[model samples]
Target: MDLNRVVIVGASLAGLRAAETLRNEGFDGEVVVVGAEPHRPYDRPPLSKKLLAGEWEPDRIHLRQPDTFDDLDVEWRFGVAGAGLDPSAGILHLTNGTDITYDGCIIATGAACRRLPEQSRYSHVHEVRTLDDAMRLRAEIADGGRHVVVIGAGFIGLEVAATARQLGNDVTVLEGAPAPLIRGLGEEMGAAIGAMHEARGVTLRCGVQVDRLHDDGVLLAGEDGAEGELIEADIVVVGIGVVPATAWLGDSGLQLRDGVVCDETLNALDVDGSVVPGVYAAGDVLRWPNPLFAEEMRVEHWTNAAEQGAAAAKNLLAAAGRGAGAPEAYAPVPFFWSDQFDIRIQFLGRASADDAVEVVLGSTQPNEDGTVKFLALYRTGDRVHGALGVNAPRWVMKMRGQLMEQASWHDALAHAATLA
Candidate 1:
């Protein structure tokens, strides 16, 4: 338990939070953060909205102020990535040909945006991921009259489409799935949300095959899966989701399925399913079992990254301190929100085996504030497992607590009755 220096990789939201928690927990030992990007820790959500829309400058999205960041008093090794790891030996290999020995290590490398096959051949293609990617895309879409075709109807793609349309550009969103955001909101609700965008003038093309990218537009697979019609576009943005940033951990001796598999306490697990002490993972690069939901979950939302990063750090320190109680277990309801155009979409909980989403409040129609003022409860058997709210923050917050408590279906209906 002789913990001294703690090394944090990936300088992302999760990594920054972990470092902050280590310092806050009175760990005065050396704290070193190695990041792939040259910039300091910065907020990412606004990259697709404010920054991509050209409404805000690059400096506006920094996660911390200059002086506040300096106050953390940690050695920052930016523009260098973690190349390898040796948890048993407590060594982290960096891409810059340097090895750092630490008493504790936390991996928060996050995820990278996934691109379509052969997408790089086209110079006009873009992605909404890092700050630099957003800046490059902003220049192409800022003029507003360009035809912007977004591949993938996920949050990032939809958000970019909304921003482009609001800036007076023609936007088209193509989703290979039956409905937009089907992975996140299910087909029914996702269709409803997609319709809202369609009503507001963004072209929504669902259940189609993207043959390949042409220099001028996207070519669709025509009849019999051959070359189809051409959707002309001046620019193309690929938001087809992301893959965990686990390339550096390929030979790190940790388990990597879809992401870094972890136990209930967020400690990284080895290939044989044993917790590798003093090593943890957070953000999109982590997958852990959630005792509350009785399901294995991997969340890619901001809230999860922030909470899990701190939780991992606390548990690591607790393990090191050999504290009074066992290392604290991380279990909580997942939550996420997305702002598109004038709508505020918030969701709590997750998709369970049962697809019973009951509309508990309001209508799908836009309210006076230009929001779809509605609340939907995800229930099955006798328990309410999740809830989705559109511009209904109070209801979402209340249900978030209830979902954490594992409220009954009847209780969820009772709450909705109160809203009625």
Candidate 2:
């Protein structure tokens, strides 16, 4: 197949890596990078941590330096969002009324922050999904004397609450679920993590339903939209969750469930459940079957995005017969880390709430230094399926190999017994 121009629909972490991989993998075609943001790609993890806390400036988070952009030999369409797509016509339509026809396309558009209805009406309400969003929220909380009400008790929400409390602000976190992260880490672990906030002087409210934002703060949803208690706040940050960026592909005929569905090879599937040739996807926007875990997953972690982007690019090249080796399956052990207060939490693998969880090492309580140190393993059937560690980097990371090899549940527990 003759490859000429390849268009990348996102100028994100995944998209940036894809462009780099294409040039490194001997794809000399014209590479065009599309970005909805005018600024260059930057790391997002720090947006909620150091950046929001005013410890790190915007420039420190850039994924690459200035001169590195010129080295890629690619055309960048900044400040232009993908408005539509016609996969059959090999065309990507931008919001600026411009269209580009490409030989191949990589969709790494990522996801959008989900907000409550009429969220944009209030000046105090904000969510951090981009550098601009973080900057705005940072300025609001920089003084740190006012009450900071954070809606949702997820990772982002809790991180922001911790940062706010650290800055001498009165912080309150509200969760609609019975417990924070109950869907991901189970009720017991979720409540365990939630306790960290309460210990640090942050008000943690779970099982609270949010009706809407008022001038005072978050209004609790009452019976049939009746009046309810208003949680007053000087500043409000909403971090409920995100939805995959797939509206641009609404008419593109690509299969969009929770995300873009792909095969084991990361090739985008059409609505009819067939691979759409020359179309590849990665990052939070794409979900593909993993032979390792025997399931399909769309990982939102930065590590997965960075790795999958490179894999997708290489796979696309190999599919077009423009690479050195055959197309390899892009299956990875999804991993992500979070820092809240003084505890560092790291999680790996795909674990369900129903999976039997056991603390393999250390206790789930705070250590002598007032920091958490423990490793919890998720077992399903006969296999050790997932692992989560709190302030136990080495012990937690050691489980990666065990997970990759599909180690037996009892054998994994046996290995941990020796560490004690």
Candidate 3:
């Protein structure tokens, strides 16, 4: 296989990292990156925290320095989206009416924010997916007197609520589930998060159905048909979830479920289960089977994206006969962190709803200073599945290492007990 040219779609964190990896691995081919967003690759995590809080400027969120591309000798096609893909011909069509032929391609298009149903009519409705989104929402609450209504109790929703509260706004969070983040962190941990928000003056309206979003506010009704209340607010931010940015590949003949389906090697697969040669995917847009967990999953986190990007690039090189050995599988222990009020929540590894959960250290109960710290471990029988820590960064970091090593449930529990 000859590697003359390489095209990377979606100039995101994953795409940027992939490009860097290709060059570092001695691939002197023509590397081109295509991005829909005009801005250079930036960090998305701070968009909700420091960026929204006005603590960091937009330029500060960039993943690399401004002259990074020049140093890497890469060409960037910014502000133009990928329209279609002709894999058989090794050609990529862009929205700007330009097409490029490539010997290898990396699909790192990422994901887009899931918008609320019928939210277009309301001008105050917002989402925090991009830098523009954070800027707009930050401007709305700049005066700090607005009544902010955040729909959903997930990480994004809760982070917005916390930031709004910090700005002196009245915040109310609405969640359809009985507790916040029930699906992600389970009921016990979700309730703990809900209580933390309530203690910080944010209203928690859980298990309620939102009827509609009006210009004035949100109309909500109880799930059991009980009469509901109209919560008035000056702004509403929806943080429900996100969908993969795979719409452009609708006719690309690639497999798609919730994301671009791939094998363990991060190679995009066709509908017939055959590999789409020279094409690969990473980041939130990728759905691959994780060998460590023995389950197929799509991890939408920074750590996974960075690790997968490098892995995908190496595999691309392997396919081109540049790699030293066979392509390696991407198997990473997923990790994520969130900042709400004064608490820093971090989780390591994966866990299902049926996994057994136990609080191993500290307590979720607020102390006299309103600070909460704790460590909880999740297990299935004798195998450790996951671990969560609030305001315990050191312990969480240690636990992350243990999770990476696949520590047994009994040993992890004993180690956590010692920490407690």
Candidate 4:
């Protein structure tokens, strides 16, 4: 089979890695990468942790060196947004009124941060999804003595709060849930995190609803639905979460529910045929079936993007063979970590399913360094769907490997205990 031109949308972690992998796989074709953002792909995790604390510089957040792409002969089209796709015509329409033809394509467009309500003044409001967002928020915190109000208790929100606290700024976290990370870590772990934050000087207000936002403060409604109370803040940072960036593919005929639907081989369902297939999707913009998870889920994590991007690239090369021998599959254990108040909180597996969980490791302490927290969530059978660790990278890493190996919950717990 002859090599074909590949166009990748969204120069994200997944897109970049995919392009590099194609070149490494000896695909000598015209590779073009288009990015909506002005800056190249950077490490987003550092944006909330180190960037907020002024530790890592924004310019240095790039995933690759400046000359890496040039060496790989990859053409980059920065600041250009992919408007839509015409699979029948084998063309990609751009926002700038230009159409580019591609033998294959990969859509790695990731998610963006959700904006606050319209009534709230966005001038003083901040977000940390991008480098610019992090820089703006970091400057405000570096200026000294600014009351930072985090409007969520997710990983990003908590990390920003922890960074703000470290920068000598008063931090207050407003979580709409009953406890911090309740939806993700269950009630027990969420309560443990809340207690840890409170012990570390963070004003965590859980189970409260924000009624409205004012110039001076936020009007919050208590759990009892009484009169709202005003909580004054200087700079408000919102980290509620994000949605997939697939607005442009509305009329593209691609099966998009939460993201671009794909098969196990990561092939875009729309352009199933065609020698020069014009469309494929990956990263946060992809909602593909996972043989490991036993369900179709959309993931916005960094590793997911990178792994899926590479998979899509390889599949594009093997399109003629009908995606045969594609080694890259979306079977990740689904892991994510956050650094807050000197405590490194790491999660392995999905924490959304577990109801009654048991703590088999480290005590619930915020400052617990190098400690592991093995949470066993058992409903019927002995199944450990999730595991949380504080400053315990090795434990989480081990659990992730076990999950990948399809280890049983009973065996995993017994093995984890031996390590403990």
lDDT of 4 at 279: 60
Q: Could you tell me which residue pairs clash in candidate 1? A: none
Lowest summed-lDDT stretch of 10 residues in model 4?
Answer: 371-380
Candidate 2 deviant stretches above 4 angstroms = 223-225
TM-score of each: 0.97, 0.98, 0.97, 0.91
Model 3: lDDT to the true structure: 0.90
lDDT measured at residue 370 in model 3 versus the true structure, 0 to 100 = 76
Q: Compared with the true structure, what per-residue lDDT tens digits does model 2 show for residues 1-420? A: 567999999999999999999999889989999999989999999999999999999999999998999999989989999999898888999999989999899999999999899999999999989999999999988888989999988888888998999988999999988888775677778888998779899998998898889998989987777977899999999999899999889999999999999999899999999999999998999989999999878888899999989988998999899987888888788899988888798998976877999987888788787777889999989999888888889888888888898899988898767656
Candidate 2 vs candidate 4, lDDT winner: 2
Best by TM-score: 2
Q: So what's the TM-score on candidate 4?
A: 0.91
Candidate 4 accuracy as lDDT: 0.77
Tens digits of lDDT, candidate 3, 71-163: 999999899999999888999999989899999999999999887678777789999999999999999997798899999899989999999
**Can you write out model 1's per-residue Cα lDDT over 1-420, one digit (the tens) per residue?**
678989999899999999898888888889999999999999999998988888899899998898987899899999999999999899999998999999899999999998888888888999988999999999988888999999999999999999999989999998999998888888877888898898789999999888989988999989976689899999999999999999888888899999999999999999999999899889999999999998898999999999988998888889998334568778989999998887788999986545688778897877786667889888767888888888788887788767878989998888767866
Q: Which parts of model 1 are misplaced by more than 4 Å?
A: 322-324, 367-371
Q: Each candidate: RMSD to true structure?
A: 1.4, 1.2, 1.5, 3.0
Residue 341 of model 4: what lDDT? 77
Over 217-236, each residue of candidate 4 has an lDDT whose tens digit, in order, gives: 67797556676888899988
Output the better candidate (1/2) by lDDT: 2
Pick by TM-score: 3 or 4, better one: 3
